[model samples]
Target: MSSQPETYEFQAESRQLLNLVVHSIYSNKDIFLRELISNASDALDKLRLESLLDSALDADTSDLHIALETDSEQRTLTVRDNGIGMSRDEVVQLIGTIAKSGTAEFARKLKEAREAQDAAASAELIGNFGVGFYSSFMVADKVSLVTRRAGEAEGTRWESSGEGTYTLAAVADAPQGTEVTLHLKPEDTEDHLYDYTAEHKLRAVVRQHSDFIPWPVRMETEKPKEGGEGGEGDEAGGTERVVETINSMKALWSRSADEITEDEYKEFYKHVSHDWTDPLETIHTRAEGTFEYQALLFIPSRAPLDLFQQGARRGVNLYVKRVFIMDDCESLLPDYLRFVKGVVDAQDLSLNVSRETLQQDRQIQLMHRRLVKKVLSSVKSMRTKDADKYRTFWGEFGRAVKEGLLSDYENREAILEVSSFPSTHDAEEQTGLRDYVSRMKEGQDAIYYLTGESRTRLENSPHMEAFREKGLEVLLLTDPVDEVWVEQVREFDGKPLQSIAKGQVDLDGEKDDEDDSAKDAKNAERAQREKDFGPLLGWLGTALAEDVKEVRLSSRLTTSPACIVGDADDVTPTLEKMYRAMGQELPRIKRILEINPDHPLVTALRASYEKDSGDAALTETAELLHGMALLAEGGELKDPARFTRVLAGRLAAGL
Candidate 1:
């Protein structure tokens, strides 16, 4: 027997990393047991890989398992595995520091060989990410690693307190593989992660996070209650001990979606989405042409309160042959569809596919296209005379549909079909763009739309004035998503959807700009009144500077004195704000300010402007009028202070 020596202090950097890992990296300390066990499994994988050249290396090993032994009094958890071990020099180099390539790098390099043959791929084994080993510090106060490499000279013991410094020493011959011992902290004793004596807690942690790790994880089983007699002369008496596995992870996506029940799908969603809400709809499909793969996608019923929270889950889970290979495989779908949750599982794909291709998988692209169409169809199916259901679905996932429309050109038509519209439509009912197009009046050549920042604002828009007069029902498109989707889906069912604010709108074949001089003397009188304010319009342009591209008479304005137009191509205020939110700062554009001469405010403005030809008061009043228009059109006020001051001055100075 050898005498024990003084335990060494952790290195400064190692101590910092350990403290961070134990205190910050893992929210649960029980993960230390999982992490340490995972490392033991990793060591086993290393020998399995090494057996490529020498099959006899681990020939004597049986079960190839990792076992856990816990002692409550000592507050220690021991994890042992019968796999590849380590020598004194190897342990010095490997566990002597943190983050050294153990088996992960070697695993990646074997992919090319695996492609040549399935047997070859299986023959070459690997345990990637040496960082998983450090995860032990998340739960344990200290850990001791003892390993003996296959066919190595002597076993090595590496000790770490997670304060950082580690000590390595040679020991007598040990079995092939590794053993990890964890000294759990007092805080951990009460927590699920470290409460090994609490069978339920241990079972929960194993099931929650490590259930799918490809090996048999076992725990001591408790006997059932002595319901029937099992005495001295009975069939059985003493309690029996058994090791039972907690995780039985079967590849879900590899199986047919029809074969998987809704409960299974929901469970997978909970695991993948990290979300608690049930899904509204599911779009599962098989893509057969060119490249082939199965997809199981979900639409969450309720938007997560933290859906837009920074670093929230995005992109479909990606799997190869039913193995969860990566989580953020953006290639399965476009960014606009990021709200969708589920799996894009590739069958023939190499397990070692690059993240870039996982980002741009050709097969996945086809699968994604098919899925987008399916989800859109599902949304379209939700449209019913039942207003409540439609509203519920819309309230939860309507924005996501608009996102798909704007960003996915291939599926724009389908996106158009499912998207909802607020129309001069029935005040109580919402209609789909497809339904709105279906209800278009005879000779209606386009799907006319009017947008504002809010449903209330768009309903009262002056932009809809002339359309209302013609009995033409204009779609009040008010979602922020509507702004972008309308741009992408410029047409629906071959009838182009045109914004009332853009291009020329004709109500009964009359551009609002055209004069109805042929009407009557009353119309003639209205025309004359507009001309009487011509100088006021001119003064407004100067006072607002280029804020009003062309201040003109009103044919479109019915009740309001003035209204801002989506008058210029690059000058649309809605577009400007949208672009600014995307991080582009644009200068305000001049709007075409159309004033209603019938309005009392405009009549008074004309008199004030004519009386004080160069009065600063007149200029300020013009500012107030323009501010009112911006407010009506859902345009943001560039100078809020000036708007308030001008209105206040006008109220103070009376008609």
Candidate 2:
């Protein structure tokens, strides 16, 4: 019980964090008020919960509320709360030195959630990070905190400029609560941050960010006196100071769906997501089973700019028993559904649970699984009930949903049902796998697809020529993730998802009503072409040995001179390029070079090789054909300069 004033240096990490808070912790300075208000609400909640367990603690103060006052002339904003406060030593520990274990554990949890893209976990750990109090330094030059523990004889006064050191001393006869005063920085006021000192701005911010705060947040304001009279003996007409409760003090998620309007949900979404557009979908659920919780989830109409950024902030606000716990808890939903925005308030969880504890909480895991199912169900409903809207959703988040096929094996079937892709039948329209299966040709057993950089390119690809000629539909997969999820989803609805660009194209079906003679004639013609091109194939295989796995007469190609195909067991060229772009290196797999037997270039080359099997011109032709195939497949040749020179020589020779 040292009553003497004591000055102490902040812990090393605390010092660093203090510096970050003052300079760069938060992007928006107005959030400082939100942070303070949230902290005040938390203190009140802690006291309320403690009173339930210990009746003696409630003896002094039964009223629990937060008061916000602003002094424009003094450039100070004060937030006072009548709740559980701290003694001198408690002040030193809580305000001066953040617990190393708690800070480290919270940091680790945040990093893990971010890395895993666990938006739910990230959101739930925000206020638990032990840094909310420091956020005040973002807009304030100096901060003063005075607090008295419940039933304690004295309170503590803590002052800091947020530099490196802080002062603490005990005060006698202090109230049983905490009051924090922030001395706004000159630049903050000059930058118009003083607007927060205005009553209107304060009201707007409170309603926007903390409308659902369970306890009343009161603010004092001056209003015109009724009947234009101050009082009986007042000198002149003046405004009267009145206390107004600013927050709605109602947990919106706790309300029944029948009671909440669409507009209210949209406003809540805007408050949480900071987005202006309406949500594409809203899912509200109140689970009353063994682990009770209420969730209100939203799917935004547009993708966020950071949706693809690794470990981006994508979490829903988390509360327990109507008490705000954290924002951006990443564990409540799976990583693939990071675009979902909303709040989850659980009655089964402890309000005092730490982030580290939440990482292993069974209730969180159960809620996470439940939430993923709900979100996917809502998306599926959108696809069936409103296809055009679902298409809009797919355009924005299809890749992320497809990624679930790879990461969330349990939900792959559900995710697949909602996926859509461009097809050869329609350049502008997209089709789901089920629809493609329904339209399958007679005797067709495999679902055909082609992956490339774009729909227009894939549709015109030489690899798809045979499928197009056969009147078979081919799905044109243009997304970068298409190659990945396709591998995971080898087949959909019992038919193999065969890539037209990979392996060999086989669209086996019932034969046409051609006469036996016509069929025999066609077979004889193919036999002759293969025999005549055998020598050329042998010569080309040797010439392009380093670049190709094997060269053979094409059965699939109908127009282009040559095309490349990956081995049935190897990665496709598109996927190989994607891997390379990501800085990953896999052993390069050679491509099978297939030459169109009907193309004029192959016919002439066969005739040339027939005359002289060792002709150098034949070797140059083989190399040029391989280069053209590479270029057609969106591949880069190792020797572009040499290919250009060889091309120029060939064109000159033709002249």
Candidate 3:
């Protein structure tokens, strides 16, 4: 007799996730079958690996495969796999609760994908979120799973209505492998709706999604005899029930690139990435060295919606000798290349390797370094062979690639070579550092750049005024990561990367027409201006002493009244904002305040300061100039309200 089923409430988060999977993630309902099959494949893989370690678990490992059954009248579809089944406790933990970390982030990405109608992103998100099983709730109102672990005598049956609760019971005659039977909803039977109970639909979905699954996926179907002849015990004119294997059961990565077609590569990409769009680049490598491995990598045409989420899972599907080890093996690639999707099959890795073991494995580390070089080479090829496609790739994942500049010190040069950026010279297309350097002024010594949150704002920044006047191109770096990378990438191709908002900039390099007389006159005029304004400079510096490192005369500014410049080792305003966003506390660094010597506003301020060095008006003008400079450089004012009050008072007095 079966034991009475014990009831358990679904975790609050799991219940909300169920509703989201069923209603919101609706781009492709056919993914339910794919997810179920993939889970079944995972179970088989686990069992296969375990059987190798423990002989007792190999009792019935001879015919390892998956089976599908459909019942039209009963309104049910069953997917059974002769693989590792869950124990009672395992079922309670894995099925009953959403135990994965980053549940909130997963839910947020799902909502964003659904709202954007990004079908590819929504589909890829399910597997990464570890909620593929809950996706079964998308089609079935009720799902029942029964199975017994390979070494266990008793089997557990788990049933859930996806309505906040589930039931579990012990069964005596349950199979050794897992069997999931879904009770399709009423709408699933309506016209034009998907009929999961149909054998043809099941075959098509299995072929499309699970064709490359290492194990055979068989389905039972009834076929009529062409001739009126009976075979063995079959009736002469009746149809015969026959089981046919549907999947190719071949590992795509195990094959040579010459044997795989473009269409096959695309189909495999869709299966692995769950992306409806084609890949931007495909890389296939077969390395036969001290550690042998086959890698098939793809660069997607668009970035995943959750690409930047904190602690987002990365890396490719790891396989050992055609046996699937894990969905994501983070050790295979660096975090910066997390957007890459594909499979890595190594013959050297143990089938029973765990995440921790993979991390410390020397062979794995060697393979990782090689793989990084291969991916970088592939990207470099794309940049050289196809500029348009490379641009598309850059548009999608350039910021992610930029992280490599900061983290992967060894490959920084190659990454910079392929990197693209928007520049002050061209607003329509992205410019490479090589192109920017090639177009540099004859005497330009540094590659000038400006970092900000937007291109439009960066273009109008007072910091870029002198660079623009000198016809010098400046790289417009808008990505938040750019600020961090620029620090690490101090120079590119022997030219220092100088921020237009930082340090002194000299573009007057050896003027041909400037003889000793011209130089003398210019120096004399500059000396006189400094002598005449020295007291005024000291007074203004004292007025804004707390806000600036040093208030000095400017040579970099042409038209702007004042602009803020960082010291040689100071952080950019953009970097400061990023640090605050990450909840980090950094030592405060004051910026240098540079006043344009020729601007009318500064001239007037100098005159007023000379008239009365202790005047309140002079102090107000100094504070106002500092506030405007801070605002113009995209830095926030420490006391915007007070600045506003001072400005209002000055305006009121003028009126």
Candidate 4:
């Protein structure tokens, strides 16, 4: 050990980055505790690495774990670990510089890391980086680290307030690992430092973030020791006080699903999700064979606060052989299922490479395929016993799940079993594609769906009239996102996506040959009527030329005068407005105005053309008919102001 003292100053950029890391990188003040403990773990890991090179350094090590000590009077907290210790020179290089990337480097090289993009690599990033060490600055007026390398000549003391610069001093006789001292801020000082009462908060954080760490994360406990020597000096001598394990430290995924009860699952979810509510449901499965894996997955009852946000929280955790490897494993589940929580513990995967290396590896591809299947199967299973619960889940997360079919081709069918739509059968029940297929009539092959902004609107829609009249079930898809999901899916459960609102639908028979005898009769009658008063149709088209897209006879509309349908490759104006609502720029599509020949209003309008049908009131009534049709199909009426003006003028004239 060096009797002579040494001093080192931090590099300028390192100081700035350190300041940013400590003050701004983390949002929670308690994060400083995790950072300091992690620093201690890093020292221990460093010593362990050195032991591989030098056996003498391993002579005094007992266990690899993090421990905490707090002094109330001094308002200081210390986190110590015995994994790997570093020398004086290394301490000065690391603590004084953000380059002391031992924590960062270890993250890239965690022995517990699974293939990247696998669950474990996510945990690897949390394990890596200097940001954690700097996080100590959040709750401390000053932070001090004393470390002796496992194979080095001496220990070094590094001190900082996280302001700008740090000073390093050579120190004597520290054990093989590292110790971090945080001068607690005033708010958490007295109560937090008293006899390590941080058990409550520490237990919460460990459960939330670090439950699956490879080593047992030990915390200070005060259980009554058995048969203490009745000392008057101690308050708990007669009661017996001792320290015991606070965390179960058990790998939950490795256990059987039945063995884990509801409370345990909920608690574990809280630990994994950092959430306050119990999980809605959990799926625990042990997969064994070519490659063994265990998955403990959860679905929250309520939508996560961050679910719809861009770059939202990816709540699932990852492990390898019961060792915590990553948190927020977005790649483990598709982006659509980001609300899912829990861990995937895999066997037969190597834990020797960096996080990036593992993500692109072949093992990840295999695991990913399997993981998606398992989750989709679990969601499908939810549909059997507790349909109402599944319906509630669908209402919150159904859109996201629909994306699974479009995005993950391998699991498309399984995801289809989970896609739910509002059907004519029940508003409360979300009809699955499988159910829709099961209920389809013989010789009726198409799966019908209608898109709208609301179920009430869709129920009243002229678009649904033909399907309803033919005794066909139509899926009521009201979500704005549902349109894209349906378009992307294109087909499901062996049936193609058929929009009921599309032009000239023939639900009764084949498209072109739909009731040939009836078609001939209707055409013959229309020709006779046309000869009787032919000028009206031409003149009505001229009267509302600006609004109508060829005032043609309608085959689709049964009860309504007319309804708007899109031209080929054109969007409905309602859908166009929705796009604009989401900040999309789009051009207007002129609607195909279809006329119901059976309606008395149409017959009257035709006959009136023989007289002075150019009357302003009659012209306004014709324009009103066009506006009503557009509104009927969820189309926005053009010239709403003009329509208002015409309505007001006609009402005044009638009054």
Candidate 5:
């Protein structure tokens, strides 16, 4: 091993990042200690797991804890943990390289935040892109890390001054686990920077941030004298140094709701989630009988950046008998609930259980089922009890929750109960399914809805014409999942979910109060119109054979000349495109073209077709009508060029 430390320069962006961290990245300097302690706690957790996995591993397991040491004379504060430490390569890769990642983007965000004078925005960027270990620079002018991997004899020392360069070298007699020593900056109370070396300050920081950490956080303090006796030390009043655990180390989940404070819950949430903001809601539940487990889950106020990323970190941290078995145990919660962050400690599962075993374990499945139900129940309760919070929750995670309707059949109804969607009834507010059902028009047999790209498009759709005229509400489903879930979910509270764009919808069929003579006249008028339009319907059906399955007079269209409607069993156009986009090769689904007999365009086309059955222009007119109907319902035309050519020609001839 070399006696002299080797110097290496940081990546260009990393130097910039370090400058930002030391100067402007953090608004609260106290959190620097919280970050260091969090890193220490993680190391401790890893060491505990490592010792369990490898019994022959040469490491101390009896008293694994984190310690904080400070020296006023040396102007240094040290955070040390007797946990799974990093080797030289790990030190270079994790601390050296991680800071460099996304440096450009981080710099840009910091610049923008500074220009906007938004400290909160600058803080948010740090959470989005972690500045965990590097955050130490916020309170310290220089930082050094000395670590020896638990089973390895050799150790490494890394020191940096938050400048462009850092030095690394092999060290002898390094303690097991890692210790980060921060050379404290001069006290600047004007900038809210305090002396981190003070005992009361350290105690306050730990209690506020890491009080619920599973491992003990200890600090050395002056032991009080007995009967006014004096010790032979250089301290004030000749007091002796005694190590005391500063943090509670209390398992927050094990404590009952009444015993724990809201601030305590929020602190635990920040610890588990690494979120800067308070959680929207906290869910606490305990199972005492057959497979017992305690769950403390939190619904975040905002979604994480990785919420939708594939293979992103998900699921709750899993612990067995107060010992962490694994993190991001995907078996505990379904994919849709991936945003939930918390810990689930099982009382019966073995600590040595492998992750694969947990997947197939009956107890795990039971826990998953119970936890899912509890989360859904919590959301449902929030919807009724706290409307504003529920709206916020839905805004952040409603898209994810809608996914449950596609995969979770058992909880489909519960998901719907909590779900709300914008509807034609309201332009700005959304309506839940129960409320939608309650507001159903008298004698309306089915819950009507329209799935499309957006509310504006759905509202302007020709399919909505009749519903709009009759003052009937239609749910506007704009999510990609909406195209699917509406199909899987057949009904809500006994009303079948019927799409206005599919099959046929009769607004007047349930009018029981209509007199017999009026009913007879209306039915006779409908029959006569159908007979009058039969020739044109048949001719258009054959003319647009490749485009439409059938053509008929529409009862759904009131103001529009024509509109397209899928058969009851046919796939929706939006869903078909989604499937095709996913590399699914499906047979082309043909939709029905429904024309309004009262419209002048249809009446003129029928009269001209009767005048000259083989008119060439009439054939193009039929194609144009079919294309118009397809476009009216947001369907793509089979042949856009041909439709355009025919439309252009007709416009020229008319002029």
Candidate 6:
């Protein structure tokens, strides 16, 4: 192994993030101590768990704890933990590269939060990204770490000044765990970054943030001797260094809810989640029967910056009888509920159970089912009991929760009960499905909806014209996932989910309310129009056969002269495009083209064809009409140059 210290440049994104953190991100710099202590507690937890798994491990298991030491003279603070530390390679891989996967995205979100002047969101981003380690830069000018992994003889030391570079070197004789020493900056009372070296300040921070930590956080304080008397002039008779535990070490989840204050819960959430904002909601559930587990989960106030990023770390920590088993135990909850943060402690789980086994274990599955139901129920309660918080929750996590409709079959209906979408019924507020069903038209048998890139797009779509004319409500779904889940979820509350753009929609119910004579006249009018355009429709369909499956009269179009429609079972054009964008291979799918018989464009085209069916200009008009319909529905033309050329020729001839 190389004994010389090696200097490395920070990744570009990491360098940018470091500059932001050191200067702008944190308003309450006192939390820097909180972050370091949380990390120490985690290290102690890991050591305890590793000892349980590896009986022959060489490290000491007797005194596993975290220690905080301060040097007032040097303006420094050190957090020490006798736990599973890191090897030289692990240190290089973990700390040297700050968020390896989404550093750029993390930096972008941080920059946005700063620009928006949202300190809470900025704090949440740092916590959720597992870059809490870098927060030391907020209070310290220089930071150093020395660690020796359990059962390893050699250790590693990492040092950095948050100046776009860090150094790493091997140590022949390092302590059995990890120690992080922060060289604190000069005190700035105005900035609220007070003296971290003061025992009072360190103790207060630890009590607030890590009081419920599972491990004992120790600190040394000098006390006057019991028998010694204080000197009136300058010095005390005697003093002793007493090793004192700073935190309460009270397991918040194990205690009753009434015992813990709201502030305590909030602080604990920040500790576990690394989020600085108060949680949107807290869930506490204890299962007493065959598979016993105590769960304390929190729904975050803001979504993590990487919530949608692929391979983002998710799920909650797992503890077996209050012993840490793993961080992010995905087997405990479904992926759609990944934003939830907390701990689940099981009484009967084997401390040695592998992650693979946990996935297949019957007990874990029961816990998984129970935890998911509890989370959904809490959200449902939020939707009913508190309107403001529920809106905040949805704004942050609605897209993630909607994913459950695809994978969670058992909880599908439960998920739907809490889901909300924008609708034509109300422009300002979103409506739930049940409310939509209740406010539905008297004879409306199917729940109507239109999916597109945006609500503005969906509202203006030609497919929505007849529905709007008939005073029927149509749900507007704009999410990309909306394109998929609608296909999987056929109906909600017994009414089938019908897409207005997919199949032919009949809004003739208004005609049913008319008298018999009026109904007969409307029916006759429709039949006469169809008969007169029957030949023209056939010719246009044959002419545009390569582009459209059929061209016919449209009941869905009232103002628009022509529009595109898909078969009830055919894949949507938007969905087809999505698949193609994902590199999926798909066969060409043709859709129907519907023309409004009342529109002058169609009427004149019919008259011109009747006059001279063999006219070359008639074919150009047919192609132009088809192209216009495609553009109206936001579909791309197959041959843009040809369509533009034909359109220009027609315009020039008219001029």
Name the best candidate (by lDDT): 6
- Maximum-TM-score candidate: 5
TM-score ranking of the models? 5, 6, 3, 2, 4, 1
Query: How do the residues 69-184 of candidate 4 rate in per-residue lDDT, one tens digit apiece?
Result: 66768978887776666666666565656744343343334323432324333222332333456656667778888877665556777787777766677777777678888887
* Candidate 1 clash figure, as a count: 14
Q: Model 5: residues >4 Å from true position, as ranges?
A: 1-3, 99-107, 229-238, 639-641
State every prediction's TM-score relative to the real structure. Answer: 0.63, 0.71, 0.86, 0.66, 0.95, 0.93
lDDT of 5 at 520: 95
lDDT of 1 by residue, 1-655 (tens): 1224335665554454444334442234554455565566456555554554366664445566667667778877777887777777777666765544323333333344344444322221211223446666656678888777778756777887776567666667666678888787665334435455456766776666555445567767665435525555434554555677766645566668677777767656654564544566777777676677788788776675435556654788666666446666677666666777887767777665666665465665666677767766766776644466568877776776677675677777776666676678798677777778777777778888876677687778887777777777788877776766666665777888777876444354433344566445556666787677777777777777757668777666667878877542544567677798889998766667777787898888777767778777777767778888888776778889878877887788776
Worst 10 residues of 4 by lDDT: 115-124
All models: lDDT?
0.65, 0.80, 0.83, 0.67, 0.88, 0.88
Give lDDT tens digits, candidate 3, residues 257-324.
Answer: 88888877887887677665678899999899677999999999888766998767678988888877
lDDT of 5 by residue, 1-655 (tens): 5347999998888888777767774568787788888888888888888788889989997899999999999999999999999999999988876444567888788778877878877776776678767778888889999999999998999999888899999987898999999998899887778989999999999999999988999999976654435445434575667899999889999999999999999989988887778899999999998778999999999998778888788888999889987888899999999999999999988888887798899999999999999999999999989999999999999999999999999889899999999998789889998999888777788899999998888989999988888888999999998998888899989989999988877788757688999999999999999888888889999998987889888988888899989888789988999999999989978789899988899889999999999989888888888888778777777778878888888899889
TM-score of decoy 1: 0.63
Candidate 2 per-residue C-alpha lDDT over 1-655 given as tens digits, one digit per residue, 9 for 90 to 100: 5377788898776675555445542334665677677667767766765665576663354568999998989988899998888877788777887533456555566567666766545434444344667768767889999999887888898999888999888888668889999988765544445555789988987876677667889999887676556465454656788998988877788899898778778767755675646788999998997889999899998887568987678888787887667778888987788999999999989876666887799999889888988888888899999988999999999888888888998888888888888898777888988899999987788898888898778877888888888899988888888888788788888999888777766443235555788778878887888787787788788889899979987778888999988877778777888898989999978889999888999888888888887788888898899999988878889899999999999999989
- Candidate 3 stretches with Cα past 4 Å from truth are 6-30, 52-60, 71-75, 89-142, 160-166, 183-201, 221-242, 274-278, 289-291, 385-388, 510-521, 580-584
In terms of lDDT, the poorest run of 10 residues in model 6 is 228-237
- Global CA lDDT computed for model 1: 0.65
Quote the lDDT for 10 in model 2: 84
lDDT, candidate 3, equals 0.83
Q: Write down the worst ten-residue block by lDDT for model 1.
A: 120-129
Backbone clash count for every predicted candidate, in the order shown: 14, 19, 0, 22, 0, 0
Which of 3 and 6 is the better model by lDDT?
6
**Total backbone clashes of candidate 4, pairs 3 or more residues apart or in separate chains:** 22
lDDT of 6: 0.88
User: Residue 249, candidate 4: how far off, in angstroms?
Assistant: 3.0
Q: What's the C-alpha lDDT at position 131 in model 4?
A: 46
Model 5 C-alpha RMSD to native: 2.2
Better of 5 and 6 by lDDT: 6
- Relative to the true structure, candidate 6 reaches a TM of 0.93
